[model samples]
Target: MKSLGVIVEYNPFHNGHKFHLEQSKITTGADVVIAVMSGQFLQRGEPALVSKWTRTKMALLNGIDIVVELPYAFATQKAEIFASGSISILSSLHCDTVCFGSEQGNIHDFERTLAIMDSKKEEYDLRVQSYSQEGYSFPKASSMAFTEITKNDRVLDLTQPNNILGYHYVKSIGEQNSPMKAFTIERTSAGYHDPDFNTTTIASATSIRRALFNHGGQIENVQQYVPEGTYQSLAHYQRQAGGFHRWEDYFPFLKYRILCSTPSELAEIYEVEEGLEHRLQQTMKESHSFDEFMTRLKTKRYTWTRLQRMCTHLLTNTKKEMMQRITSTKKSEYIRLLGMSKKGQSYLKQVKKDTDIPLLSKVTAMESNMLNMDIRATCTYAMKFPEPARSEWMGLEYSKPPIRYNEETNTFI
Candidate 1:
């Protein structure tokens, strides 16, 4: 059976997500849709509003055939590494094609941009470096360089988050020279960073998350944009001791990590550049809230997402040496099945024999340095999940079974 793979964070599964799943199936005519989802931390460098278990269940209920984790290392990185890890997993699954949401739906145009980047590799690199030297953010500098080299307005789309990811998806596939085809579904919803819940149909995950965590918007207000199952799952989490999580929920711990950390120790953390350590140290003393810390650190040169990711590495006690070892040693070599449908299970059964890397449906069954980070991240996230539910979520990686679809009941069991 032909399978289509999708890369997702599903920060909280909403209508936009369900729409993407359905459209990917229709667009690819594949028998099943396999989703590579993030666990506790998202690419935006924040904790997921809901637990991965809850999000996995949400995906299964909404039509994602199977959900495997994207592992914390890749899940929290910049887009290139993030896309590279995801594409490697999908390729391992022998997916025929990978579909992702894009700002510009046309695949050919995206490929053209990729071609320019490839052909002008050195020049592009140099220009990016030059612009970075001029105080522009890396992403902005890269975009400016690419636009100058390609001389194509559409090349500018790479600056947009979704389109940039789609571009990297195609680029990573090409770098691996894998057989998987790439496709995109144009995003026709709210802007990715829009923090409003006014949209009734397809709202951004940012907006939905803000509505759930910060804004007074309750489940009822969010219901108009998410599926019924998503609403129930979120409400259930809310009723639990922790409620829906936000980055601020764990701010005290992060602040403690910051204040207690030595400059040498901060420098040892992954992605802590020359001045960033000192800057973060100063901010820890000056800032009162998580938002304020982020605001103080966020410059044109360093995006909030980048700083948050650096903080995550610090909070998890992920060291520079350890990260180098983990990344160099593992190229997203394992796939942890989060949940799956009957069709998904069948596909896995058929393809498991042919897969090159490890497929882990059970965490305790294997020992991997790469997966160790995921477990650590889960433990850290569990600490913020209210009370008793925290321990359950803490051990959830090992205790819970991957969601199995009951075909007759048309529900997850």
Candidate 2:
């Protein structure tokens, strides 16, 4: 069976996500879909409003075959590392094609950008450095350098979220010389960070989350977009408790972690470099909240989001050695199955024997050290919630419910 791969954070699956999945299948003509998704944390350096397991179930309920965890270290990282780890997993799974959403759906443009980046690395690097020296954030510096080099306003626009990630996806695949075909689906109307959702078209996940947090999960605005199972799960959580989860509640713990760790220790964490540890150390003493510390330390070279992610990596005890080791590996050694359909089950059976990586369907498969750390971190994170919710986190498994598929309809239920 042909398999298509997707790299995602399904934070909470929405209508746009559903459309992407459908388009991926139609575009790739694949029988199975595999996703390398974020865990409890996402690339944005914030805890997921809901657990990864919950999101995985939503994926299966929406339209996906298999789901695998990207792990905390890679999930909460910069674009390059995030792309590398996720692409590595897809390559290992022997995916025939990988599809992702892109603001610029033109593959030729992305390839051209990659070619320029490859040939002009030195010039581009120097230009970025010069721009940084003149007081520009890394994103802005790189954007400026790229625009100057390419002389294409369109290429410069690739600095946006979807385009940047899409570029990294293509770049990583090229750098690794992987056989997988890369494709991009044109994004719909919703801007990723847009927070207003009462629209005729689909709403962004950000808007949906905002509505869920403000009014409750039962909002009619989002009900049509999300799967019934997803709504049920979220609404269930809300009715039993006072409200849905929020990353802000965990901010104190994250701050505490930074405050307790010394500069010497912070220096060892992944992405902590060039005396960033010192800045963090000094800022932690005076800053009370995560946002405040990040704002205080944000400078020309470092963006606020970048600094926050670095702090998150430190809080999670992600080390450079781990980063190096994971990258050096040919591919991910294990697949932490999140959710799948009956057709997916048959596909898994066919591929399981030949799969280069181990297929994991249970929590025990998380290896001793990894399991311990993940469980402890999840527990600590859940502590910010009330009594029953805290207990719920403890029992939440890495795997999700298997979705049933109707062969005749060729659709997931």
Number of the predicted model whose lDDT against the real structure is largest: 1
Report backbone clashes per prediction. Answer: 1, 0
lDDT (C-alpha, whole model) for all candidates: 0.85, 0.75
Model 1 lDDT, full chain set = 0.85
| Candidate 2 per-residue C-alpha lDDT over 1-413 given as tens digits, one digit per residue, 9 for 90 to 100 | 99999999876887788889899899999988988988877788777767766677777767787888886656777788789778988887788899999888777778877887888899999999999889787789888888888785345266679889889899889877899999999888898888886566577888888877677455565787676767776666566545655656666776777778887888888778888877777877897775576678888778767776776676668787866566565345567676677767778787788777677777676574444445555665566677776787666754334445554565556
TM-scores for every predicted model: 0.96, 0.87
Which portions of model 1 miss their true places by more than 4 Å? 152-156, 386-388
Report model 2's TM-score to 2 decimal places.
0.87
**Candidate 1 similarity to native, TM-score:** 0.96
* Candidate 2 runs further than 4 Å off: 152-156, 216-221, 240-242, 274-294, 328-330, 366-377, 386-392, 395-413
Candidate 1 clashing pairs, residues 3+ apart or interchain: 242-386
What lDDT does candidate 2 reach at residue 105? Answer: 79
